[model samples]
Target: MPKLLITGIAGGLGRLVAKMARSRWEVIGVDRDPWPSAPDGVVVHQFDMRKRRFEDVFRTERPEAVVHLAFVRHFRSDPATRHEINVEGTKHLLEHCAEYGVRQLVVVSSSYVYGALANNARYMNEEHPLNASRTFPEIRDLCEVEGLVGTFLWRYPEIATSILRPVNTLGHSVHNAIGNYMKIQMVPTVMGFNPMMQFMHAEDLAEAVNVALEKKVRGVYNVAGPGAVPLKRALEEIGRPYFSIPDTVAHTLINTLFSLGIYRFPPGAIDFIKYPCTISDKRFRQATGFRARHTLAEIFASVAP
Candidate 1:
């Protein structure tokens, strides 16, 4: 069986992908934390992605494919630490993938890279400019990571590099800013701004990765679920009570709360609730012949209290 290496394998998405890919490949997982119970037939490595020892895993496993998902998403993490992990760690991973002759590299990115702006198109596509850093400096590392991977894809045609930019991913096991925000008893929103948002189930995303590896779908693809829903409607569907506050007051409150460690989302995330950054998955669907099997209601139910 071909060897497959997955970073962040301890994460919900990574574990799901490992389980799905196990039937086809021998799986090796690397993460910063140890798993209480790792998946069957998968080797697990616990360590920092930035450590030079990471390359040793590449030498030992000699994986034919790699799925990179070790990015830090917590707002409380030091910005410098996040950057070192997201950007520099990715750089190291890409370098080692090239050196080790890895045939396929799948990098998971977020739709937030498009930047939530008042003037954004109704449905941004893959060619859309990544302006996320213009407002959210914390995500700058992610944008840079995409850039580095894009350059690597062009410079190294031998490696089938597939980049997936997925929208708000929701699932019972998944822990993300949007999921945490939705699970709150009382959620917050910007006054008079109920932006349209799209969500993808973690299972669908894992399937997309599997398809990419199986089909060698090269280039950037935007992976989205069935449909879009207004922020308020999403809250209502999840049975969460949310009140809107003026944008200025919301920003200030979020900033203060984030600084005090009372809130998990940063102030920059306010724009996501204030504007639409919905993405089109036409390219991804066409390339992999994959469609999300879960409905919007199912997605909402996954995170419901």
Candidate 2:
């Protein structure tokens, strides 16, 4: 069986991919946190990605393919610290991938890399410039990571590097900004802005990663669910009532809540609800012959209590 190394194996998506990929590949997982138990054909390693010891995993495992999902997504860490983990850590991983002869690299990125701007097209494609930092400064690290990976992708054509920029992924196991926002009993919305949003179930994203590895899909692709929905409709479907507040007032309240430790998301996250960042999955579907097995409703239901 082919060997596969997955970073961020403790995360929801990483764990799912490891479980799903185990039957087909020799799976080795690395994360900053330890897992209680390793899945049936998988081994888990606990260590920070930035440390030199990370290379030890690559040296020993010598994986033919790597799924990079170890990015920091929570607001628990400050921007500088997050940058070290997200940007610097990914740089380290890429350098090791080149040195270790990893043939295929699948990097999990976010649609947030494309800023949620009012002027955004109905469906942003992979070629769209990453302007997420213009509004959400916290995600600047992610954008930088993508840029660095893109440069590496071109610089080394020998490695089949596939970057997946998935939209908001939701599942009971996934704890993310959108998932937390949707679970709120009283959801907050910006006045006069109900953006069109797309969601991909965690399983579908895992399947996409598997496809990228199995097929050696090269180039950047956007992975999204079957369809789009208005942000308000999504909340309504979840049985959450939303109250609209002016942008300034909403930001101030969210900032205060963040300062008080009542909210985990930063104030800049409000832009996701206020503007659309939906992506086109046509390229991904055509290249890999992959379609989302879960419908949009099923995605929401999976996360719903």
Clash totals, every prediction: 0, 0
True-vs-predicted CA distance for residue 149, candidate 1, Å: 0.2
- Mark the regions of model 2 whose C-alpha exceeds 4 Å error after superposition: 256-264
Looking at model 1, residue 43 earns an lDDT score of 93
Candidate 1's C-alpha runs over 4 A off are 259-264
Model 1 clashes, total count: 0
What would the TM-score be for candidate 2 when compared with the true structure?
0.96
lDDT, candidate 1, 13-102, per-residue tens? 998899999999999999998877886789999998888779999998899999999999877787788888899999999999999989
Scored by lDDT, model 1 comes in at 0.91
Q: Indicate the worst ten consecutive residues by lDDT in candidate 2.
A: 34-43
Best by lDDT: 1
lDDT of each: 0.91, 0.90
